[model samples]
Target: MGLLDNLKARLAPAKGKVSHLAHEHGHKVTHGLDRAAKAVDEKTKGKYSDRIHTGTDKAKGAVDRLAHKDEPPAGGGDTFTPPRTPPPAS
Candidate 1:
């Protein structure tokens, strides 16, 4: 293997262990993200409320993606969650 591949090989086991830990404690990690965002928002007096919400959403999505990586896109075993469309106007 090339130097890069050899390095990756050596790191694979550690990576796997870290991944497992993250999966097990994913909710706690998400909570910490929420707390940090709240702290920033309070420190700035809600000046960045919009951006904070956006960032929080993106972060939550990422956490969800990783937490569900082993399951098919849909845990229901459908392999996907169809994008929902808005209801037609009355």
Candidate 2:
């Protein structure tokens, strides 16, 4: 096996543990992220509020993915459909 494969093999066992921990403490993790973001925003005087919000959202998403809570529904209709917009009258 190549370097990446070997590394993945070694880390395979830890994946389950990480997922379990994330599932158990996901709310606490999210609360901590919010608290940290609020502190940073206060320190920055709201200068980077937008960027901080974005980063916080991405972090939360990562946590959800780690906890496997982002999985698609078991019903299997996972496709996305764009909303239709009506054309303006000429």
Tens-digit lDDT track for model 2 on 1-90? Answer: 999999999999999999999989999999999999999999999999999999999999999999999888787768876769876789
The residue pairs in collision within model 2 are: none
lDDT of 1 by residue, 1-90 (tens): 899999999998886676677788888988998999999999999999999989998887777666665565555676567669976889
Which lDDT values do the candidates have, in the order given? Answer: 0.82, 0.95
Task: Supply the global lDDT for candidate 2.
Answer: 0.95
Model 1: lDDT of residue 60: 76
Say which candidate scores most in lDDT: 2
TM-score of each: 0.62, 0.79
Off by over 4 Å in 1: 1-3, 73-76, 79-90
- In candidate 1 the C-alpha lDDT for residue 18 amounts to 65
